[model samples]
Target: MEYYISNFSNVKKEEVKIKGSKGSFIQWLVTKDHGAHYAVRRFTLEPNGVIAPHVHKYQETVIILKGSTKVCVGREVKELHENDFIFIDSGVEHAFYNGMDPLEFICIIDYVDDMSIHPVDRSCI
Candidate 1:
């Protein structure tokens, strides 16, 4: 068996440009290169940051690691804090907005060739 080990400090963070997203950064923790079926990523959002409503083909699981966030899943909106986790079904519209402080979270998703994100109407937010 093959394995890869990583530390957050040793990983590089990249600024990801998602439509309607502001102050968002991403760190790829585990990926296909690691021979994993799913990918693990860490995301950080600056204060008042927003990741607008969008949907993807793959299901996603998010775990809040720091600070607080306002989340919208479909028509329902809720506030989540550290240690909170949520599972989003494939094609379900969702978004994330940071609170007063920066927000951090871990996102896990299935590895797929098409992970395209489709924008959802903001009226639902």
Candidate 2:
């Protein structure tokens, strides 16, 4: 297999708009320029924006590179600061939000076949 470095500057940042979401919320700069085993992505959460509770097909790990955030897993909510990290198991329902300023972070996840995100509600908690 070939190896290389992917830069955030080169990847297009895409907005993550959930179907039932009300406002402009999640944005992601994603890159899959390396091995297929995983994907590296940087996310920016805008104030008033949100990532509604959802389930993933692959396990995910996110590291707080900059800014603070509020993460919700099930009915539990916790505040996270810079340098913090969180792990979410596959099929686990969760969500996160940016505080006043733009919250930035890096997320690495097992390469998914289709990156299927199933939007869920509090009832799933």
How does each model score on TM-score?
Answer: 0.93, 0.81
Q: At residue 46, give the lDDT of candidate 1.
A: 93
Residue 122 in model 2: shift from native, Å? 3.4
By summed lDDT, which 10 consecutive residues of candidate 2 come out lowest? 22-31
lDDT value, candidate 1, whole model: 0.89
What TM-score, to 2 decimals, does candidate 2 have? 0.81
The local distance difference test score of each candidate is: 0.89, 0.72
Model 2, residue pairs in steric clash: none
Q: Which segments of candidate 1 are over 4 A away from where they belong?
A: 123-125
Indicate the residue-level lDDT of 19 in model 1.
Answer: 82
